[model samples]
Target chain A: MSQPASNAKPIILTGDRPTGPLHLGHFVGSLRNRVSYQDDYNQFIMLADSQALTDNMDDTNKVHRNVVEVALDYMACGIDPAKSTILIQSQIPELAELTFYYLNLVTVARLERNPTVKQEIVLRGFERDIPAGFLTYPASQAADISAFKASIVPVGEDQIPMIEQTNEIVRKFNRLVGKEILVECKAVVPEVGRLPGIDGKAKMSKSLGNVINLGASADEIKAAVKMVYTDPLHLKVSDPGHLEGNVAFIYLDAFDTDKAGVQEMKDHYTRGGLGDSVVKKRLEAVLQDMLAPIRARREELAQDKGYIMQVLKEGTMRAREVAARTTDEVKAALGLSYF
Target chain B: MSQPASNAKPIILTGDRPTGPLHLGHFVGSLRNRVSYQDDYNQFIMLADSQALTDNMDDTNKVHRNVVEVALDYMACGIDPAKSTILIQSQIPELAELTFYYLNLVTVARLERNPTVKQEIVLRGFERDIPAGFLTYPASQAADISAFKASIVPVGEDQIPMIEQTNEIVRKFNRLVGKEILVECKAVVPEVGRLPGIDGKAKMSKSLGNVINLGASADEIKAAVKMVYTDPLHLKVSDPGHLEGNVAFIYLDAFDTDKAGVQEMKDHYTRGGLGDSVVKKRLEAVLQDMLAPIRARREELAQDKGYIMQVLKEGTMRAREVAARTTDEVKAALGLSYF
Candidate 1:
């Protein structure tokens, strides 16, 4: 069961739902990690348009348009298309086939018990009205991961249960079929954790209007920074301000290159005299520096929609090859290989 | 919206889970109608091997073996391969793809509310532990029907909800995607309804050990008839027996050639003096007469597994063409037709 880890390059599966453009939260969470991972791992970046439709079924135009937006985000963030397979989820029919097979291995009770799915259902106010696709997406996610035989899935802390569910399916499938055809994936939680909303909420989301998209222009970036939440009670510049739960400090901690300056600012604020405007100005400058190049690349990529579509088309073909190989193995295991 | 009744042949979709050989119950409920329907419509007979895994996930070998058993049953029952397509559901990848897409249109609450699925959950003792595949199967069935653009689906009374669910998805997809890519199917409920088990249970199922297989030999037919439930109070031949709810009379009503003789026998039994043994013997003979040719045909077909496989492979290819066209339309409607 143990392959020599030193010899084989481990596979990493990661993707985003193409419901909206990539945001600063995405950059801090998974996109940035994907950039460097291309050099070391067998990486497959999926534009999850199908999974996006799980909840956004009525907003398919958004999903369709965001496929390119997400691709542009990846290209702008230095994720070399040549080094990674950037596939569209719906384009790989094999994933849907595999998902159908994997769906059998999971129980409705288990899906209901999935913390991420459960939380999302409540968050979306779906309660009992959650779409079957939305509830069963963990199985689909498992299929997506196992189709490429991914050994590592970079996910958030909330998505750990999904990884557990994937491994359970892998084990159940292998045990029942008497063949270890699917690989179990480990959740590689990024060190940066979650970047909070500009409103100081725990999550940065488009629905909450707290997100600064990676593709934001200079004006949009400034406007978003101006709305950043800070010490509301600290009315006077000389008043001692709360450093904890402050969005400005948090953004600075995440994006600002000047660590010593950030600490000095924090110390002055805690002691007495750092103003919100001064701190906001510094945070805005840091964000502008980080986003300026990405925004420019996105604009350039937008001009060549044909190339992005080609990349996805070619990558989807490549992904289908891998997924088809896995599905064939699965079919053979289950004695469904009629051909 | 209404296509002419004369110009185009309406399509009918029907199938069975390949869990066991077809039984007399299946014959009375669906198979007999399917045979006659071949001339009136374009028919697709699917061996639902994939759908069978929703509950029988650990029994792949059973599913594999029964696929051939089901094909043999179809052939033995006079389902002409030339007039109707005999497809294995798993062989058509487009069905799974379509299922994934339609799954987005149905909510979990709707699945939970499906009467057939609800009853099945209780019947299978699944309760909260229902397999996700089982819960989501209505969507899969919708896919199976719509992939062929099937206008009519022949099902039992209990399956009316399934057809309704299929129509809902079809309407939802066509409405949301702004394209009439899918056709809603009408459920054609057969008049015979569910055949009772030999033990007098309302449903005759293979798992209940009460069914006579369509390919039962004369000896098997005799043995099955001997165990048929008769009136418990009719201990003596002269004792008055209940005509209704008697399994022997039910089987006679279903299979006996002489309707007048059967009616006379029923009257005699209700009026007393008709022995249970006498009725059982008559049933045994009638069943034997009906099953003999089917048994012979099945035995002959059983001798040619390669031919059966070839038939399925060819039928699957044909089925794929239809499913692929539908999926392509769905993709184009969803704006996923990148090519």
Candidate 2:
């Protein structure tokens, strides 16, 4: 008898901290990619409110409301519920139990050595009194992934170490229990690293006030594009400009459809012929056109707040089912399950 | 309109790590006192399987089965379920979530500095590579107390700092949330410190091979009593014996009836008229009578293992209701509650 064919489609787990609404940076970084992956993989998109509160513990009110806003952004960005399962982290009690068990498999020093946590501590300036939640979040993330038995985790290149830590715990847990109850996930890095901000910073961030929101109005898009930073040396109509560090050209590369025309515009700018105002106007039109459909969908979603909340409520229930089943297996493997 | 009356009957929370069957040491240190508190306070007896797994993670089968065994011991010891809530720690998902939140309130340095933790580290020889779970257990204990709004935590004197840490988090959480959502707890140190082992060691422990389990057979009790440590300086029947450091006398003081006779026996032994054999026989009789009902009940309970399991299943369900409500309030205060 021939063996049954192994399931070919991979399971994908990805999420965002419900700290704010989605912006253009999120669109370019992961959300846009997630829309494409929806058809190829079984996806579980999580709103990591518990992890968000690890650092934003003082601003929980923001996290609480953003859970709905973030889910709405996902729906508006084309993460179909039929393709992706969206969930709130704290709603799944099994995740919390799994996290507690995994904490035993890792050491304090190892957590301290986690690159993502080290970078975050420096960025957040939590010198001596760092919260224990912040230090042990990698374990929490491990619980998040392993709870769904997700085989593929979409994360940035800088976050590969987090996947490493998760896989380490997965291996240790399976070895200790003598069963492969948990799945080890690999980090799927995107083709693009990160999109720069309108201010031309290395990365776009809401806290920096340089992000273009996914739901920007036409006038808002125009205003953000107008403020885009370019080479300061290109002062005159005929000045030779550098496109290497120009954010306007980068946006065009990331969003514009007329690649040949955009390249021609870039060459003209470098040859000291294209005026700065003329190039800015071209970039503005491309960005506005690219943002039009997304803005339309966001506005449509915004009109029905009740429907958006329903999506979250339903998704959270669905998520809890998968989470509960996974936790049952995990606790059974650990011999901690009473029922 | 008057203010809501403060809840008067002080709430008492206590538990045992279900690593093994309850022994004579547990009876003297806490269980005996719990039997009395049932009438005067709102009491909760938790079977701490999650905490036991911190050190016994490899022996989960033992931990899982012992949860019921310990609960049976409580029932046999007259810890009335009608007066006290008997629950399992791992079954309460809210406790895990509350522990996750409290982890942020405590610092790594502060956990390392806890005197009881330091002493345990030395005792266990976990110099540098202590499991993160063991390191964070005080925070977990804090969650256990605060989850029930427990006002009186019955612990040994050595555990005073743990209660202090719990109160610290309670105060900090209330101050940070700008609401009195958590209540500070007071430690109820029992009148006695600890019961020494049959070998006359400082403490009775399962690994130490000196414990007299509550369910020991009569012959086993006789054998254990025969091995009781006495003053070696008194070699003959007429030789004077010292009673100050005798562990047998301490056990008698804590467990035996006929205190006047026990005191007379102590004086007789020290006055060089009584021998170790007479004292040993008397101690054996008192212990046998004390444990007779407990052993009988334990045997009857052991005959129907399913019945014991049912008790825990029902208790855990009841415990989760209270825990869920408390966790909701806690998450709301921290701003992490998505609902």
Candidate 3:
């Protein structure tokens, strides 16, 4: 579905917390989708090192190094520097200023009510002594979007509340200041909210030990595919098998181009004829085809790490100009313009 | 009493909120004292427009204009650009970054317990809807001090809690980061916490209609002196009078250089021999002597407003270098340095 013609080309801001390298789940869920939006919208792919350090404060050296790794992953996954502006969060001071301004628009009570933050706090087990930075990240995210004048934010269903918070700040800022200083943003919920892990877990994550990196080699991909979860009930080669909970079928549904052939295989498995080994081999072939070009691109770019860093530096410089101009307008709206 | 090292002058960080022009209370309590500190220690005076906008967000135009006014006030009051670094707060984005980092070092509960903020909330009558900026200002103040590695912070006795809050953050940051990344600032409480209003009120403020502007002309000064409060019980010239609660004596104690003469006059008045008019005339002469050169310098500087702005711009640029360097060191310590 597309928006109305009167609506501007939705400016999109989507990024990853650079805790580690991007993985296959990220490819299917967001990164690959972002590559498609590059020519269609004003895109900003950020390396959120500052946000990552909110939880990884004690291990900031890891965060610092991962910023480059994540940027490389974005390039390897087909996010174009010519179309999409990739920025390091720590390099743009305007984002920090915008965050400070938006902090006033939110309350402690309202921040505590954020559903995503609430769940993450529980998941992270920071019940009593939660880091203030982690709690206020939603406000910081609002700043990131509003700083770029981003009108469309691509996020999962779990992150819809973050968009709500951003729009709330936009409305409040405009109303309080008697001007449309900030643009309201919409949440674009992706078709697939999450991709399951190789272990058949509900989510793919670094901590889960099931994520396959975007830059994984062909051999590595094969090994990972070998461990892909299949039906536990099926014992014999000719045994009637269920394909519903089989992770191999899920991967086929998400990544395969020939859906009809995949459906036929699934039906054959359920009809008491096909074996799990044949299905696993076909699923592995489809995944390899999907990741082959990406892996090649990652390898080509990884040869000269300096070139990747240069791309980031150039993108950051371009991003900073836009950010600075937006900050000036914001400061003007707030009557903070000095000259 | 002085510090242990007699040759070592205390480093001071003091500033105005830049909401309005410096008035008589500001002149007597802080501005006059800042002039002398230029010769003694490393003095960093700031025009705190960002902090001013916490409460005055609606009046940003005023804050923007008053930044120059406050800077001019500093220069006119003899805060030498050669000896003191005068800067604007919002111009330095590093302060915002430091504030963000310092927020992690402080707790919401600890911020809520700040007595100064509590009193301010009551005074501002923002009981439940206290702006988050207002609540977190102590942390921002910590950034302001720690950004400069300020060793002495000149403040009133009522602001002791704010100093304590800054030191707490300093200690916490050092402990958590495992490095002495911040410096602890001592509060240099002035002998006179505040100057009483002309009407003998406990404090002089712009809202109280008792302030005399530092830029007041001779006629304005003469007219303001006439309103100075004296002993109400001394109905006749010969009647013995009380001087303890008198506003005129407070000003004399704070401003007058002829302490022996002023003491003798106070004794005469208490012994039922001196007239209130005589003491008032003496106080007027002493104030005019103190204010005459400042007013003349202000008049001279006002004619060349461009020159004053240039001074401010130059000082702001110099101050930014220090702040930027300090911020780089801070980011490096936090391992957020992109470079």
Candidate 4:
């Protein structure tokens, strides 16, 4: 439960906005990696409810209700709470305090120039009316990373800029204060990179209704697979199909365990032998096999909401202990430790 | 002391940054009002060491050392910790947490457009390199004001925009969250307004070296008065002098209790035959008489640094109770109070 040995494995920090239950995109992008990394590193999985409120401030009820949903998803996905700490962001006051201090090291111009922030502004259509929290969240994210002294941040390709921004603040603060109080973090990009939405969009998001939740039921999976974007030119079984931009085949590539079997299916579809329903049925079988266990685990975890909260509360206490040590170091470096 | 009665006077929130010992300008600007307001209203006096570090982040030892210096000045200037809470800014973690929440209510563009922040950026010559903390301090100020639920915030006229900005966030939060959880604050500008520096500049700033410390010794008082700006056109003490832009007369108008004597001096100086040295010596006498009791009190308080710190610790505990309650309400309104 304490920190690893003196020559411990490097630490990893990763989490999701508690806006909704995590989905297959999360599994392919970071969750599955977190499951694999639990034993190799000291992992801290955070339920970023505070960060979720930065944009969804009006929907606190959703954010509040989703903290447990997200935790359940993590547990069902094999993120063992005993091996990896599961924390609620708002419960740690030290992170907010550390964020306040980090803001001094960054500039509005720099925050505005952040690629992720800029893209989100355009995506959200908040051109001139961006929230201060939304705009400065890079600094807040930097706080989340550095407060834990997290050296490895598991993120997607698009989030490379955020990791760079975190390191910039770390360097700026250390240089200005003449103390290496904060550690720089590097992003560990997932090999799967991104999983397109069921509708063939670039990202699988809950808001778009294109996502298949990690704990989706068999019927729900079949319904989502039926709507999956496919080759419109393939009118009959004998017509040649285009595999490129086919959402069903793309998902099969990500989830199908048998690479040779997936290759044979792709070959048969391109050569006009496999029908869309036939390919979808194959994907349904693979997904149902993967999701059944998760659904069962999620159902069992859902029955004990108090236990889920207790896990988060206990993890928050442990997380706060580490964050407090870092905050004390930060204050000592800034000469703000009055006592 | 507890809050006032049913028809109680409005609460007032005012404070000074602990960057240095307060000077004559602080006395003329706000400290004097705080002393009298303690008897009529619920007043909360803060030693804003955290805000001081927004710009002076690298010089925290200076900030740390000055907290006690500023607190001692407050006590000597008649700000009773028993009647008016004298809390340190960094001690109340709730304020920082509240600031984080309030940041979401404000926008980056709106913060940049704040007139006070804009003017300060120009004045500080920080057009390109402005610190994020410096730009967002208005929000932090808003947190300071709202955390205490102060109905009245005593500030300079230039800070009117800051009050407007705070109220904007308050209204936005209440409207968006569909709850009236925050109180809007009114700026209580003093009639005396800004005090001119000894060199006749518009501000008596410690960095400008134009200030006479409130706890100045008699010798320091004479030295500062000797350098006070006066009418340059009155050669040989025989020429008529312009009353406008005379720093000495301005100080007398603010400090001299004998209005008739000050007017006679002004009339004599305007009509001619009154030497600058004579006027300076007379003003010196007035300032000395006023500062004697303050200097004695400051001397006594300076000897008991532990007592001053204990007072701050106790007052911080009291301030945290009020701030914590407000934070809880804010969270409940935002649906962030998970526990």
TM-score of chain B of each: 0.97, 0.96, 0.94, 0.97
Worst 10 residues of 2 chain A by lDDT: A1-10
- On residues B1-339, what C-alpha lDDT tens digit does candidate 3 reach at each position? 213266755567889898888888898778878887888788889898888888887677888889877777788888889899888888878888788777776766778789999999899987777777788889889988888878999898889999999999888777767877677889988776789889888888888888878887878888888999999998898888898888788788888988998899889888897888888888888888878888888878888978877777787788778788878877887777765
lDDT, residue B202, model 1: 82
In the order shown, the chain A TM-scores of the predictions are 0.97, 0.96, 0.95, 0.97
lDDT of 3 at B24: 80
Per-residue lDDT of candidate 1, residues B1-339 (tens digit): 535367678999999999998899999999988999998799999999999988887778899889999999999999999999999999889999999988899999999999999999999999778889999999999999999999999898889999999999999999997777788889989999999999999899988889999988788888888889989989999999997789999889999979999999999999999999999988888888889999999999999889998999999999999899989989878877775
Predicted chain B of candidate 2, TM-score versus the true chain B = 0.96
In candidate 4, which residue ranges exceed 4 Å CA deviation?
Answer: A1-5, B1-9
Docking class of 1: medium
Chain A of candidate 3 gets a TM-score of 0.95
Which residue ranges in model 3 land beyond 4 Å of their true spot? A1-10, A218-223, A226-245, A271-275, B1-11, B175-181, B218-223, B232-239, B273-275
Give a tens-digit lDDT track for model 3, residues A1-339. 223267556678889899899898898899979999998898988898778877887787888889888888898888899899898888888888877777777877788789999999999988777766777788789988988888889898999998999999888888877877678888998897798899999998999999888888888889988998988998987899987668889988988889899989988989888988898899889878888898888888889888887888887887888788877877777777664
Q: Candidate 2 docking: what grade?
A: medium
Identify the runs in model 1 with alpha carbons over 4 angstroms from their true place.
Answer: A1-6, A233-242, A264-276, B1-6, B231-242, B264-278
In angstroms, the error of model 1 at B13 is: 0.9
Question: Model 2, range A1-339, lDDT digits (tens) per residue?
Answer: 112137756778999999998898899899999999999888989999999988887788899989888887898889998788888888887888889888999988888899999999999988877888888989899999988888899898889999999999999998999887888888999897798999999889999999998878889888998899988899986889998779898988888888999999889889898887787898888878877887788788889988877777788898888888888887788778776
Worst 10 residues of 3 chain A by lDDT: A1-10
Q: Candidates sorted by lDDT, descending order?
A: 1, 4, 2, 3
Model 3 per-residue lDDT at A54? 78
